[model samples]
Target: MPTLVLLRHGRSTANTSGVLAGWSPGVDLDDHGRKQASAVAERLRPVPLAAIVTSPLDRCQQTLAPVWADRDLPPVVDERFGECRYGDWTGRKINDLVKEPLWKVVQQHPSAAVFPGPEGEGLAATQARAVAAVREWDARVLESHGKDAVWLACSHGDVIKAILADAYGMHLDLFQRIVVDPCSVSIVRYSETRPFVVRVNDIGGDLTGLLPPPKSAGNKDEVDASDAVVGGGAGTV
Candidate 1:
């Protein structure tokens, strides 16, 4: 099968504002994220991608615009790779959510974690859909582009982590341990026996987001929860 390059969308407005922004509409990439998106073109210049896949979300779409704009291959927008259906959690701040009991389940036993609200779905379901999408795309790409072909997919952090978990045969409960920073690249290649995770959360292209975050003016203690170092964080620097 073709090797897959998983790219998480650049930092977004929600990221800077300390919001989860899961499947939230009108959440576009922030200024710093725009620059990171542009740099992605230059960073991947050396790799010849046979196909481009993306989640049907604005942030992911915008993150990939620069790269596909200059290329002949149009991106395959797949909803399966979209952000986790946070439902009531959508648009909520991470700091506030951390105080909820569900937070513990999400961190420790994500396989059993299900977001509250009408639109919510369990983390296990999210992994199943995302993994299915990637495998289907991999086979399609391999058949059309050949076994040595390389492809790219732009998606949400959690969605990418779930896919990587499947690739490594890791349990969904442990997916939280994988950190996929904004604009980072994680590569995986599938063979007859097993999938090879070539890279995981490989940060590159933009350095500005890696510098220490600026102190928030509002509350002296107020810091963007997205900037936390756990699992690569939200890159709010």
Candidate 2:
């Protein structure tokens, strides 16, 4: 078995501005996002991580910076974990997108939703690639680090939601029910029989329990989610 921790990149400029960043470049984290990144890094410091995998987007890289600084572990850039390609809708305002007929399809039946344009990618296709990536990574980690290995995957909201949907054995159309906020953490442990979801959208928690007792011992930084007070933020594809 191996533990996979999915962390959504902190709030980005596009998020604050109410735009869908999609695969657009030059979108970095805001000040509040920087704080959220730092806080998440501190929260996970007590847990032993085998590797850190991140999307190639700037926002994801920026979010991983603080964790790299704290743990000195370089992140492996994986494009499979990148944000959904919104095609012609890239960089468009959410309010405007909501007015489109396809927006309702995206919300109600994501499996049938497809972005417009030559490079448009379907929502089901996105989920397929993302789930494949995570499963492949999970197998690799188990082989290299053995069971109990824990790793972090930094990606966008929709991307993480798709992965969670697969982990829960839910269809792509039901994925919209899952909410992956900026800087939020969700954990999944994959075993031979099934996958166990330990936590979802956990802003803060005593993850020390998830860590091996030997590694977590003597770590006074361990604090329960209720004891940790952290602010919330938002995100988009």
Candidate 3:
């Protein structure tokens, strides 16, 4: 088993402008986003990450840039971690999209929601693929590394929310109720039986405890209670 850290990319121009930058190219982290990325990097600096997986998007890659800049490990780009394909709504503003008839379904019943375009992707399908990708990565990391291995996945808000929903065993319709903010960190430790959700939507806090103590040192069996800190937040899509 391994600890998977889900990190959403920092605030982007689209987030500030209230636009839906779904799978849209050229979307990058804003100035404030750069600072947030730096903060997240520093927060996890002490943790020994086995690998870093990132969505194949500019914003995600840009957000991960600072973290990987000083490390020898490069990111593994996975398209499954990319943003929900909004189809015709790809570059549209969220304000205008809210007026659409399917907006209610998107917010209230995302499992039934479908992007209105020929190439659009369904919310359920998005959740399945994203969850599968995370599970695959988790298994691969554990097999290659060890039970206490730690890794990071940089993705979009919706994608991270979908993965969180799967980890919580929640139905897809209830996924919209999970809010993953910009540059937030959510931790999940997979075990032989089930996954333990250590933290969710953690923006800023003491993360030193998340680092695994030296294996070659004494008291390797001792568990840090602070590592299991739990908190909650209101949900938003």
The number of the candidate with the highest TM-score is 3
Candidate 3 residue pairs in clash (backbone atoms < 3 Å): none
Q: Candidate 3 regions off by >4 Å?
A: 213-237
RMSD of each: 13.6, 8.1, 5.0
The lDDT values for all models are 0.85, 0.88, 0.88
Per-residue error for 64 in candidate 1, Å, reads 0.5
Model 3: C-alpha RMSD to truth? 5.0
Clashes of each: 1, 0, 0
- Sliding window of 10 residues with minimal summed lDDT for model 2: 228-237
Model 1: pairs clashing at backbone N, Cα or C within 3 Å:
179-231
Return the TM-score for candidate 3, rounded to 2 decimals. Answer: 0.90
Please identify model 1 stretches exceeding 4 Å from their true place.
205-237
lDDT of 2 by residue, 81-180 (tens): 9999999999999999999999999999999999999978898999999989999999999899977789999999999999999888899899999988
Instruction: Please report the TM-score between candidate 2 and the true structure.
Output: 0.89
Candidate achieving higher TM-score, 1 or 2: 2
- Local error of candidate 3 at 207, Å? 1.5
Q: How big is the positional error of residue 60 in model 2, measured in Å on the Cα after superposition?
A: 0.5
